[model samples]
Target: MTILIIAQLTIQETQRRRILWLGLLMAISFLAVFGIGLHYIVAELDAIDMDRENMEIATGLLLSAGLYVVNFLIIMMTVLTSVTAISGEIDSHTIDTILTKPVRRWEVVLGKWLGFVGLLIVYVALLSGGLMLVFYLRTGFTISNVLAGSSMMILQGLAVLS
Candidate 1:
């Protein structure tokens, strides 16, 4: 219960700082750009009478590239948010207040870490799923093994985060 309270507070603090909001705003815009670009690319591909085989190749490359970019952003954001949450509190002397409480230091740290981990998971799901959905809607091509791909990406993120 204490850990959960701390975790909730940590999330609220980041929201109060506008970190999560800004990250989400940026991600939405990124998806919008990808969607627009995909629209144009698909139109051109159809206009050129591209065969299904070549079309699949083109779409596959685009999805792979987009997925890679999302993965990279996830790793970067995890690092950035982690640094800001930890060192920012320290520099602002907010950590002093947290430590003055009844909670253990490890509980404080773990709670904050859990809050960020939750954010990362949501971020990955939204961005990767959004990108793939855009790709499919624009091209009529579904990604093969989405479950496997997303799981791998999540694992990669966890590895980088730790």
Candidate 2:
């Protein structure tokens, strides 16, 4: 119960700071740039009457590249947003109040961990899902194992978060 409350507070604090909103804006910008680049590439390919096999290969390669970028962005955002989670509190002396409370030391750590994990999961989902959607719409194809691939990205973020 104490952990849950702390986790909830952490989430609210993050939301109040508009970090999530900023992340979304970053995601949208990435999608727009990706879409425009893809549009031009497709237009050029169509103009040259590229063969279906070559188009498929190109599309697959492009999808892989885009997904890689999405994963990288997710990790970067996660780390940047949560880097100061605990240290900043201590630095500001805000942690003194919380530590004086009845909350256990482990509870504080766990709560902060859970809160950031939840935030990162949502972040990864939105950015990765958006990337997949845009890729499908632009190329008229779907990549296999999206969730599996995204899980790897989530794990990557978690590894850094720890």
Best by TM-score: 2
Candidate 1 stretches with Cα past 4 Å from truth are none
Q: How would you encode candidate 1's per-residue C-alpha lDDT over 22-78 as one tens digit per residue?
A: 778878888899899878987899999999999999978888888888887788777
The TM-score values for the models, in the order shown, are 0.89, 0.93
Q: Estimate the overall C-alpha local distance difference test score of candidate 2.
A: 0.87
Local accuracy of candidate 2 as per-residue lDDT tens digits, 42-86 = 888889999988987997888788888888888887887788889
Number of backbone clashes in candidate 2: 0
Off by over 4 Å in 2: none
Model 2: lowest-lDDT 10 consecutive positions: 15-24
